[model samples]
Target: PTLRTSLPSSSPSLSPTSIPSSSPIYISRSNPTIRKPTLAPVQILYDVTSPKDDIKIYFGKDDNDGREGPPKPHEVATNVLDNSGKKYLNYNDLGSGFTVEVLDKCVIKGARFYPANDREGRDPSSYKIEGGRRRKNGRWRWSTIKSGTIRLPAARIKVTEPKLDPRFPHAEILFENQREFQMYRVTFPTLKDSDSEHSMQIAEVELLGYFTGGGVSLEGVRTTPISSSSLIAESSNPVSQKKRFKSTGTDRAENLQHSFEEKGPNYLLDLTTQYDMVGILKMNGVFKPDHPRYKKLTDKTGAGFISRVKNDALVIKPAIGKTVIRGARFYTSDSEEKYDPSSFVIDGGVEEANGEITWRRIRAGVLNMPSARVDRKTQNIDPELHPHDGVWFNNDEVYDMYRMTFPETKDNSVNYEMRISEIELVGYRSTRKLEESNFNIYDLITTIYFWRYEGSLTVPPCSENVQWRIFDRPIRISPRQQATLEWLIRAYRDPDTCQRATVGRPRRDGTGNVDVVRPTQAIKYDHLQVHCTSANY
Candidate 1:
């Protein structure tokens, strides 16, 4: 499942005067558009986790609630344990141990655990506590802060010291280093000794820390667990997989004000003026004479049909080590709509010191060309397409890229060719200028809303290093344009072997249609972030 964080539509925009001097700032205009919410401080046990599905987790602000059964609809557990004279949150069935994730980043100096019953109250003989933090690149890293065996009668246990008195009922474990982290996990020994059985019963757990931000909110967090068997079945036969379409709008769509920014300058719009078109591979034929697509043996072959557009690639060398490409804008051709690429892939790479280009995939998905909209008065109307408007991907992990092989076009049998009047690439700088031009990339762009996530390239050697941002809207094309696109030929197929053959004779048999689109790929993991923007209109 995708975790969606919707920015408030009516969120207060940060004025130029309100920005902090310490923050890294970028200048779009004298008064650039920027909006971000204020961060706050908070301390709370946001979530508790256990690998065992049967174990129940209870948490609340009040320590004495006596409700029973599983947690209420949205609340954690309700029951409390009264051991001796002290009270603690009731947690039983110690399959092993559990983890607790705090609301936000904080420095945890220590923790207090109140045991329930005397037998179960005895601290684990051997225990270890671990901490985890999320990196800027969207990966989690964990390390152990302290680990050791607990002895009886050691009440105040400092991680550095050997032992202390007044232990058992309540043990305060202090750490040496007060490093900041988002979550922590505590594990216990699995040995089924007399003391180890049902030893996980705890009355209350308290963490000591200086936290930042309102405790982690689980409001929009979604989780979908995929099994290995489902993956195997999808890989074995892709056609059997269900097709799904992504829906538009969030609950807060009406109140959110979005701001857009790229790490580097927008050099993609200047490609035609700054870079030279070094190559162009046309979709002509190149097959053998013996191929069945040919009418006669002498008229055997021509250049075989090229499946995808090879000439569409435009390489760039940015000065920065890492480039985050957010989204792209595609333009239609003047004469042929079939020449427009309905689906495409974007790749990013760094020219290594050894002169090898280590490529990383940025995005691979479908780009829908808008069709004519029907009107009540008129039979059909031209689509409201513009050069600045961006066509977005659904961001559906399962079907958006994986299940659908071709663009949602009128005819599936026609061969599609890669044609474009212009292609805009964002978030990079060009090495040198090839010629001079007055084209302004920003002029064509209107306000855009997008969803971003960390993903790998759709093609092979799929490295998990790319950051993807998909726009929320789509560009439009005319009905005639859609028809022309479906009529384009991808390749000439040999009727005999049903393989690609050169256009020997004008034989329609075994003719390949325009289908240069790659199917959507499945999202392996579920860490997705969405950044949305509304149009000025």
Candidate 2:
């Protein structure tokens, strides 16, 4: 079924024709190319969920470099088969037998498989564990790395390879020799002489490898390798302690600089650092408050601030040229969860030679802030509660200079204020190299887990071009910092009006009320892909 988003009559209309022709589009989410260096043994585990009695697990390079399409059977490198000849426990049951381990010398030293069932007519003798290396010309050279017959209930096959050269004290040295690839394929093979049909099902596929401190570029080229000795030294200590920075009404420069030096420029700290807060606009009005349609901004139910990135814009240029952003990671501010933004829109485009900024709609989605279970007795995030951290947006088109508008929120009764600590953007980069352009967001977080999907911007000119990568973890802020966020929001003034901006609807009572959350919308599409760091960060 085709997926569609239903917007309110007052909301902007979305047309499929609005999608830009030159947009960057990724055929599929590829596994993380970078691998952290490790000295310990590495293991890749497959939790099969298939009901089929026979299955084969293939590991190595795919035909299209494991990017464009599914893996083909002929492109197998290292493979293991589960042919017990009889149904065992559930596919994901532990000890049902499917595991692989690589020793420090970068060799496939061991593998375990479920033993074949011994029945009157069953043949439980034939099984093979094969390993191969890929040639530079994109061809796989096959050889049986290890081979043995199955045991009674379970079989553990171990192989001993030649010792490594002591001169080069790194596991990557072995990888360089074999030219190993990083791709996995699981298929249900047909029975030898049976007419039974088989289906493919999988519950989980896990690859456990040591942190090599080395990384692979987007093009599958290996970067400079780090030694095991250095990796050991680095892993013993934490990278850096999280520092708390506050933004008071008067102390902006010092705090800003400290944050940049500590967290780097790409880490989302506050709106003031990255964007220029243009002004506040009423939700119902399309034009700015200064426009003739809405001559002056009024206290309304859906009023939000508009902000644009700084002069030196942050651009997202994927190697493919265009991409669809589906979602994002929104960190909560110090204020109560009620003040968090419930809905927003992200726009991206290039800046013209003139001072003007050209805009194209990128993504629209609701911000689902996790509940802050603040104990009345002691004001701190309750560790016991789930989702007390960050919310994921797995939903885009590509844009460099992103313009985000927070129009609606979770609660409308209170004055709306967005208090986000950080907004991490995760995805692939083009060959032009973002580092050359001073892109610091990459490698900000050691291990990143995210969900990717297709969605539209939540606001006007709702373009469906965004590729959302919402971080699974949330950034924690202190109570003092939360209070600081509230202070900053109220302190902000409209540059055009030279008047205080209205954050929420005005009530008759004298008491203060703040709410800027947009209600959750129905999900139109269901396709979601998950990506995580390959190494155990």
Candidate 3:
């Protein structure tokens, strides 16, 4: 039953432009100045044709306990018709064909194997093998998968258009919050492609915050459970993991909270990056004690992050602000009758869904999409009701959102903890298809959770540490940008600063109008970056 796709009405809007109070103000509604992003002294990426086909090895589920045995002798094995489907297995299977889609929960998403048919790319001396048994065709060939490499270490940043004091709101500080402030760390110039100077192994580091406006270079790639109202966070250097303890107390303590029904197979963000909103900047990220829960943080309150409260009063609730919930809806609130923990209200309306996302296109030769003309009565709605379309931001659109105003410094003294304005990027990609149609024939083909991390902000108490950058080519957006990202994630989930404005029914309102709430920031994590280094629970 995995077949869903219902939203594509048309979306993409930002056009507002208004800074002229004689311009040059920098970013100060009162003490505003942060735009520092120049750090890349850490890196890792591998595609040596197949490193256990890129780590995430699977097969035999119910979440596995089959006890990890078969599958890798080079892990190119396959078998069609599994997952309650039917049957097919050619050498247990290993590449050439397979594809099926449906996740954001409609479930079903497979792609077993795909990478063998001599698409032509071999010559390590033709594998050096040729002197077989009975002749050269009797049996015993060897050499199907063996080429592992993913070294990383990098740093190259260049930004110079500032000599400010038009009031002073200039920025560039990536994770340096007074261990004696440390003169602002910005050293990076090491990766000629790195063969191994340890190849820059800092795994999941953090600290990135920024702001630079207009002329349209607003590059952004953030959204996937990384928030402090979506900007300014630092700290990515600390983890011990107890030592890889495999205990598993129920889906790894429920996959360590952040499940809005599977948002990005583990952090991803890619806001069509070309670079924009230039104002505040800072960055730093790494997490490798040997990851999996490496620097762990069951979130025992370091103020670093992960808060949603109200399950019988853990209190703190006012969710929704991953860019107004990704649709860039218009959410405005810093004060309006109620909902105000301290700022957020950009209301521009969004929440359109008919969903569909499944990939393996590498240049679109086939991953499939076609079908969707929708209207099976539009899938008939009420699957617990989502219904969103809201646009309410008038006052000339909240004065056109203070006319994009984000640069203002001078005695207004901007130090929201030292200046971290924005940066967030979370990503994932894993899909396989060895061969089959209509559904069924080898499984685990869709681990394609999308998110393109790193947007910069780390420096200044390193607020929630977010200097995440993951890009080696991964982009796919239109369906009206996924129904304007389901109407900007339902207008950036405002839940009212924490009285309860998040969880289900477009935030419920049987006609009560008490929905849409967000505001509860304080999970700063000091220097954040510990990519699931452990999860035994």
* Highest-TM-score candidate: 2
Q: Which 10-residue window of candidate 2 scores lowest in summed lDDT?
A: 230-239
- Model 2 scores a C-alpha lDDT of 0.30
Which of candidates 1 and 2 reaches a greater TM-score? 2
Question: Tens digits of per-residue lDDT for model 1 on 454-482?
Answer: 87765455677878887665433333344
Query: Candidate 1 — which residues are off by over 4 angstroms?
Result: 1-95, 120-123, 133-141, 151-168, 190-199, 213-537
**Weakest 10 consecutive residues, lDDT, candidate 1?**
395-404
Instruction: Give the per-residue lDDT of model 3 (tens digit) for 222-290.
Output: 112232222211211112111221235655323322222234323222211111121111111111121
Q: Which portions of model 3 show Cα errors greater than 4 Å? A: 1-477, 481-537
Better of 1 and 3 by lDDT: 1
C-alpha TM-score for every candidate: 0.23, 0.26, 0.16
- After TM-score superposition, the amount by which residue 303's alpha carbon in candidate 3 deviates from its true location, in angstroms, is 19
Q: Candidate 2: where is the Cα deviation over 4 Å?
A: 1-328, 373-400, 412-537
Q: Model 2: how far is 427 from its true place, Å? A: 6.1
**What ranking emerges by lDDT with the best candidate at the front?**
1, 2, 3
Clashes of each: 34, 50, 150
Q: What TM-score should be assigned to candidate 3? A: 0.16
Q: RMSD to native for every prediction?
A: 28.2, 25.2, 28.6
